[model samples]
Target: MTGSTVGGQLAEELQEIRERSGLSLAALASRTPYSKSSWERYLNGKKPVPRQAVDALCALTGTSAGRLLALWELADAEWSGRARPVSAPKEPQVPDRPAPSPAPPTAAARAGVRWWTVAAAVAGVTAACLAVLAFVGGSPDEQARTATEPPVRNHGCRADTCEGKSAVAMGCGAAGMITTLATHTASDGRRLELRHAKLCHAVWVRATGLMPGDRVELSLPAGRTQSVTAEGSLDAGRYLATPMASGDSRTSTRICLDVPDRHPECFTG
Candidate 1:
């Protein structure tokens, strides 16, 4: 089967394990070193599952890693196309000649020695390939131990220094920008800024002066929209949305604060 097919199967198995464990994606993320978003991608087969992640899941679900690792091996082999064996080249034919009388070791003996050397070289290469495969497959216990370790954080920016920086600049991804497209004030006097990051190719809404129960919604082109509610009475929050398509020509994006009869606000570029 193709690598993608195998990967999808693996993803399904992981999803099933998560469901059987009665853990939500967020809960799974909390138990593991991955974030909820990372789990989403993995379960959906949108990204390759890491060995560490597999170990984490197996540990969390009390499942043996043998079966899962076998599936992963199949998928990985297919994806890398390295499972296919290479055929050795055929030896060139030589014309038949009368056998020479037995003599001291000569050029032919040297050629035989060289052929043995080539054979040894091929064996070494094959051994190296096996070693690589074994390493890539990894040990279940090692992976489980790694999963128990704390998640690594980006040292470039902490919560205090993340503001005003593009997600990529903050180590999120390669595609990101810190430029603001426009800014507007909601009817409730809350400031809303339309920010665009080129690398992410997506737009974000930053709202300040928000209350604990306030709800913010973003309306984008092609009828796409997303909404989030404020938490813990934070005065400022940022929400990122799906990547904007290149064909979208809307001059402005809309934001609505859901309060008792408050109108939506627009931030024009």
Candidate 2:
């Protein structure tokens, strides 16, 4: 695919994620190291999104980052296409100067002198070229590729490597994290989910509209469980996360949210 097409598609996805996240470019800039103008260019397809920016946006939105990072890989490959050779620069022409006056000489002498002049000119040009090559150290095409090459991506770990960790923080969300497997909405409008981080071989709980004293939990077989409590009221749209636990689709995983004075609500996936 063309770089523009790939970049535009990635940009559209990022813009959608940003809008859903309710974070402004300035917020994104502040949250990450990127500048506001950089985020603007990234969302507008004026440039390819770097791996760091993609991961940062996904973490900010509490969204799975795998799909976006995959899209970014494609865009970067297109943008950093094969480098072309840099053509030699043409030397500027100088007006011919009058030949210096010389005494008349034999025909053989004139030929030898002319041959010597040509040899010296060739040697001078060759030496100058060697000096340039020594200074440059590498081909222009190599330098161009180095300049435009994409940054290395670390997609986080898989399976055991991701067990009991924050998917967003460890970059699992940027790779093999999956969509919500099960969802539950509480009587008070709080929402909970059993999320499958497939690459992580684990599951976790995420809840929104949490109130102070709200407790969220993710449980697996053999009594392994992890939970989190809201210390204070949280924004309705902000998600509260629990530490992950080892589990997969083959096994049932349950997520629950318990509010004070209310019965615990739970769902299994």
Candidate 3:
């Protein structure tokens, strides 16, 4: 098989498998955690598919990995000087790449080495890691609740500070949730939070503290913008006057994408 032929065949097979599974390009992208554009490039034969990517595609399509590996071998042989028959001497070990490291606990590692000590250490580390992960990773649904709950405020809400105004304020509380990143930091020290509902139409926002003349603008992914005026060094925070529509809300923001039919947390502007 020629290089071009192999590339074309691999792409075609992948696309065929995806279609057979009744998945659209975007759906496949969602399942794979890769971008839609990335999927398009791989399926178009415009780039060499990574081995892991191939394995993932095969698994997702319910195809056998062994057959795909065989195809890869054929492609490798064609690229080399040899144009051997598809069933010719198998060169699983491509000469260009270095050999992969052998699995641990092989004869080499076991030779004249104490295994019990290493095993004990490994067990201890594994246990510790699991404990830490358990403490850190909370259930997503629970987290959504904790974040949406109103933030605790010790003061009141009023529009004037220059007039020496001081009182407690009341407003809805919200929390932001992002599916793409494990943790997200607001660049401008601000975030939007919304009540978690089956169908949340809009988010409310308020700047907690603003100087007499402090002004901030809200930006979201896809060039959405809103202007907010801070009232007299807001002691509690300002609440969003209206709901912000979904879509590209910020021109310069690239942190998140609005997945269709999914509830989105108010991302930082």
Candidate 4:
């Protein structure tokens, strides 16, 4: 099957199973770790569905593993099928034969690692250097660089970024920090809506070029900010400021900030 066809079919089957189980999208999501929007994407084939997700759905709805596994195979085939196709069928059947243990990492994976990993390591080194520079009385140039640099947004705060406090207020905190300040002008000169995130402490937003009626939404986890409402005539050049936090932790303090597009220097700084 084509990618779209298999994806669409899997989505349909998933939806069918959900309905048969009498589970709302949110309720089904609650049963599993996947989010409601993620389930929607799986059902609509907006994104590739993970095998674990399929397994979770089967476990939740008490669906037949054989059938669900078949659907998963179909979806996997759409992306992996070759000119002649391999013996791996559209639906994987657990045969009577026992499975072999998996092999170690391939030479390629070990060779260079991944570009993203390298980039992340580099960013970490850079952040550490900046933190050191910040701790010590750094020069004006160094301070400016640190101030202008974009924040490295880390997804899992559990141990690395968080203190691992089991309490909800301490552990389940979210925050969005500022990494860079940019200058932009609105075409036709209209006020842009300011947005931010609220983790533990309420976010403090200070922005220019924003008039009344502008709306803001705080994105948790990733702490992405988006504008929802707008008012007043937007000006060409304006400055905006927002103070946000997820409450300070022993391991993690500030949330990683996103580097806006067209700000490579900011990221490097």
Candidate 5:
């Protein structure tokens, strides 16, 4: 198999594990040495993920790394120019999945290492993403629940003092602080959350994920509002926040989004 093929398989396994854990990519990165950007690339198959990174994810979620290790070994071999012909442990059981590329000419090179390792983990690792109704697939029917963030640390600023300052930097909206007062998602899939730190008497807008042209805003009772626009690719897939505001955002304040090609949408908790 080609490196890209193996990398893609590994990526899928990682993404599934991530989703099941109910932790956002940001959370995964925060708990591990890897940066959010690194997780983005690793999960998206844009770069070669380190073998040890899997260990870190397993550590955070309390999952055994055995199965993921199998996929990684296959990916590592391809990246290192060592390709094998055998299907990933029982991959033959599901002849229905489409492959990314054709296999190599022969399966002769170091067969022992790949087979032994693959057999140990392949039994249950890939079946969720690739078999029959239950053999190699997962339940996709359940609606995806919003991933909650941890509480924001004490920002030590409230009301007037927090106005016009980054809620995250001030340690307010960056963390869940409290559970989301309200949440909204644009038709195009950009997400928004109203986060509050009651002790600080502050509330802010946290757009969990944004695109190039997305805009985020939070408003207070007296026509006060703060907004920021998404900039470049670096900003893409990143969390963006608005300055802090006061009052019961659950009812009084309005949170809105201006996304490309869609009508502006607003929500209040």
Candidate 6:
């Protein structure tokens, strides 16, 4: 099938799964990392569905991702056709100089002009050499400082500590330190913890008292967010956000559960 046809088929399948799962657009958005408008575009084929979004939908509906991914590969291949070769820059044409004076100039005047021209050429060359030296040498202290600096230390638990441990348990929370930034309870009485680790410099939310298929979403200021769904009758789930810098005062964190008729709970860091 053509790439567009394959993409259309993929979109149709995604919509079918969502409908079969009996979740509204808002509910899907609440349970997944994507926004409602993004879901709309993906379903209608107005935009390319991201791989992560595809995986999330498959997980939510208990559908296998293999077929969807194959369609995506075809669509992506069509979207990214062979790159066109770049053309080389055209060379500049030098304008012809006026012919030398029909009558020869005086010897003294010619000598003076030649001297000035040589001086200007030397000055230009010297300036270029100085610029190169400045770039290559920098400041001695700056060079020494860089040379003597130690390698950056890796954060979070390593070796046995991380074995069989959940991401949060291994000190991979926001900022790389397992600090609880806030807590909230969902309308359904599930407890949630907003965690930050200094080393990872990212935020995540953990929800407890969940049931099968329950989902949790954590949104942070500046449009960072994550979502995860419960599996296998588990009572807990966690959603992790992208990495961020530590100690930003401008952003707030929010958490929401996909339970019906519930609003998001928010806290400022």
Per-candidate TM-score against the hidden true structure? 0.33, 0.44, 0.28, 0.30, 0.42, 0.33
Q: Give me candidate 6's TM-score against the actual structure.
A: 0.33
Candidate number with greatest TM-score: 2
> What are the candidates' C-alpha RMSDs?
16.7, 16.5, 22.0, 24.1, 15.7, 18.8
Query: Residue-wise lDDT of candidate 3 within 1-269, one digit each (tens)?
Result: 22258766877787788788887878765444345786788778776554445655664565666677677555444434234443322223435655476644568665435456555666777687678658977643344334432332211121221011111112112123211112232444433332211122222233332334343343544555444444454322433222232322222332232223534324443
lDDT of all predictions: 0.59, 0.70, 0.43, 0.45, 0.66, 0.58
Candidate 1 per-residue C-alpha lDDT over 1-269 given as tens digits, one digit per residue, 9 for 90 to 100: 22258888999898899889898988865555477898899888887776557766775575766789888877666445545667654455658876688765589896897698679778988788678759877654444434432333322233324333333223322212345677777665777666554433455566677766676666766675656566553224433222232212233567666643555444444
lDDT for model 6: 0.58
Better of 2 and 4 by TM-score: 2
1 versus 4: better lDDT goes to:
1
Best-fitting candidate, scored by lDDT: 2
| Model 6 C-alpha lDDT per residue in residues 1-269, reported as the tens digit of each score | 22246667888888898889898889876555467897899888877676557766776575766778787766654444312343433334648877578875689987787677667776777688678758888643344334432222233344333322233222343232467777777666777776654444455666677766666676655665567667654334433232222332234766666653545444444
Off by over 4 Å in 1: 1-4, 84-269
Question: By how many angstroms RMSD does model 1 differ from the true structure?
Answer: 16.7
Worst 10 residues of 4 by lDDT: 260-269
As for TM-score, the candidate ahead, 1 or 4, is 1
Candidate 2 overall Cα lDDT vs. reference?
Answer: 0.70
Winner on TM-score (4 vs 5): 5
